[model samples]
Target: MGLRPRMAISDIEVIAPHFKRRLSGVTSTVVQLIPKQLEAGVKISTLGPGLPDDLPKLRYRDLLQCWVRPSSGKKRIWHARRNIEMVAGIFLRDVLRMPMKLVFTSAAQRNHTDFTKAMIRRMDGVIATSGRSGAFLEVPHTVVMHGIDTTLFHPPRTNDDLFSASGLPGKYAIGCSGRIRHQKGTDLFVDAMIALLPHYHDWTAIITGRVTAEHEGFHAELEERIAKAGLTDRIVFLGEVDDVKLWYRRFSLFVAPSRNEGFGLTPLEAMASATATVTSDAGAYAEMNVSGSTGMIVPAGDGDALRNAIEPYLADPGRAKRHGENALAHVTTHFEIGGEVKGVSAVYEATLAGER
Candidate 1:
């Protein structure tokens, strides 16, 4: 797609506030979406701490600039994806008398706390990240599913020697990524790999995520189990990879065994990388993949089911490549990154005109 010239500071139309410093799903969403918005000529800038230095960001003191009405629009859109950011936006617009409209993106798949509902009710507009999330909302919201940057996560030009390039052993790799914890179902992934890898010597399994201090015991136990099974070399743990996009492209099958999720973009990330996936029915994995064709979806937290889903690919690498090809096509047709940014752009326009 063509990028419109980046809007100047004076002409900025949107303020994407990210209060959290951690690299969470919400933070990742902002990092992915802002540049797209700017490329589309929507004069956007990020605000708050913990964002990458590469993003166009306004200083905290720049919050005062919102009080100045834009020459072209009535107010700026304060797009928020978390409660703290949303609450701050409301206070800026209402109490501080800033010329801004609050828009909150809700991704929770179940009922929310009363306090959260009360906050939602106060927003100028709300966006549900998935259709499933809309059911759990008390206030009205537009549903805009998350999308992946196809350019960043596409099929490699040639991956015949990817393992050699990655400097890891084995000809083929299956990977599961996310935080190392029981809720993320990392244990299930480890167990399944331990049970299956002995037969598929050509295939190695990798887990890429960090184990927090609180989950040290849980992480240690999984390592002990793998050590006892004598599969340490095959079942490897790559804690916290900054280049996860590269890792996704190296996998034959990308498994997301999450026990629960608000909504996950990992399946799409895997698909965009031209990797076949075996994901749990948690989050939007089922919605993202055409089960059994493009990818597979198993029952959440079921090691046996996950292993069964992955066995055929281990037996037949060619079929796995075909599935990966299908995944790239499916993601391109339905979940390209531009599709998501365009949807939100429309909302911004309508809401600016007081029509949303």
Candidate 2:
């Protein structure tokens, strides 16, 4: 059937779907984008489960109405961040004969699976989360790096402060957060902390994340190793936390030593919080760190390199503070969520204009 304008005034112009029940990079992206997009005057809503109830939501039944072309003679944008959501878009746009535009934002920095490639090839448009991720894509795509909420992550007021009022005993805490596994290099962070903290008594290294059932042994081994070094008092494991942004501000230096990632955002979040960052050259971390200029970037999985990168900051807290300021300025200039929203809206407008 030929395309026609949406009949209802309540139709959502853009829909960001959260299909899974778990919190992940995809869900976080969707959650962060909605408020910014809405501020820019886009009639957007999220569908499916797992999203916070605060943001506007469109019921799944409402999705059927979005099958028609939207008002202003434009195609409704259905942005998907995962394989299942992509498949749903295909069903809505191709199988169900919907007039929506199918868009997928890929954050995987590695090669695409044959099945994934097949699904991606059918998208009306593709958005790669980074140039590294784009390089692995077999289809034409736009590169839009994720941005941080600078308002929420901005530097703390003067005076060293306790984070989340948890009374964690350090003037400055160094933290590495994410899923605890070999791929995330949590053990590397542990080893680096064990080697460094005895000398720099003022700073304590902390790791915050969930160790899934499969990685329990790996987590236990790391903890045992930390205990053996008599550094358990210096190296703390907070597990998963809800007030992570608050914790980021308490960190004078934030470490992300992942052996692999898909454009990791923790470093950016740290920078936005005005914290110096040390990251391995996995994902687009090198892009975020700017080497010694903004923060530190080291070789991935090299415990020695990670330790070396952090010592300079530990040795000179003044330098760490200045680096944190530079990081804040850099993120405000280049990585604010406002800029990301603008980029996505530009793509949406172009897609509506029939410029694939």
Candidate 3:
């Protein structure tokens, strides 16, 4: 799509807020979803910093115009994905009396805090990312799982030399991407690699994502363990990367061994890249993979189970390739971005009509 003119505040039917300045999973979701939502004819604009310059957005001062209701008789929708944004929505609608309805999307699988529960109770509509997350909510909610852009994440062509250019010594790559922390099970993945890589000499292990100050000790511990195993050369860490999809393309096998999560998307992204996955039963990971056909799923936080689940794929490259193909087909059919846009748009329609 080409650059478009700025939209009038009165023309917007939905305002998605990205309150956080740092790039995160939620920020990525907002960036990916809005363009598709607009393509599907939802009159939406974002309200916050940290978004692309090309995206339709409102100025901070534009909050004053919210008092002027949209051209449609129905109140505009204020879709908040974070607690802070929810508070902002509540203030605008309740205190300032803006003509807007509040909607919050919950992705946390754990029980809600009383503070969070109180704010949720004030929302006009709620959306849960998965059934597991929905089970924790006290109020009524629609289950609308997230999806990825299949066209952007598909397998690399035969002519692609992405791995060779990386200069890493391996014919195949096994990857784990996300924060390097205990909660993300980065140590479990490192342990699995230490146990399995010696048997599979042609494969190399790659870890990507940021390491904040609080987790620097955990990151050091994992690196030290790999060094002690004398596999430091075999297993590599590429800190945080700008082009994650390219790395996904280079991977023949992907792992997501998180001890806990809130509707994880790494497995889906890997699957879309035609990379087979071995993931723990955290968040919506199990729901995304078809176990034997697409990949394997083991109990969360079990090191033995994690290693064993990934062993079969390591033993046979042909088996991994077959499952990777299956993964591509499954994701293309079930988890395309359009499906998510449709589900979310329906909720917006229902909320505006006082039906949700």
Model 3 agreement with the true structure over 1-356: per-residue lDDT tens digits: 55566799878989999998887778878988898998899999998989887789898898898898888767889999999999999999999999899999999999999999999999989999998999999999999999999877889775452576678998889999998899999999999999999999989999999999999999999999999999998999999998889998899899999999988899999999999999999999988988999999999999999999999988998888999999999999999999999999888878887876
Residue 20, candidate 3: Cα error in Å is 0.8
* lDDT by candidate, in order shown: 0.85, 0.84, 0.91
**Which of the predicted structures, 1 or 2, would earn the higher lDDT when compared with the native?**
1
Write model 1 residue lDDT over 99-126, tens digit each, in one string. Answer: 8888888888888898898888888878
Order of quality (TM-score): 3, 1, 2
Off by over 4 Å in 1: 1-9, 158-161
TM-scores for the candidates: 0.94, 0.93, 0.97
List, residue by residue over 111-166, the lDDT tens digit for candidate 2: 88999999999887888888888999998888888988887787887444455355
The full ranking of all candidates by lDDT, starting with the best, is: 3, 1, 2
What TM-score quantifies how close candidate 2 is to the native fold?
A: 0.93
Residue 197 local lDDT, model 1: 90
Model 1 steric clash pairs: none
**TM-score comparison, 1 vs 2, better candidate:** 1
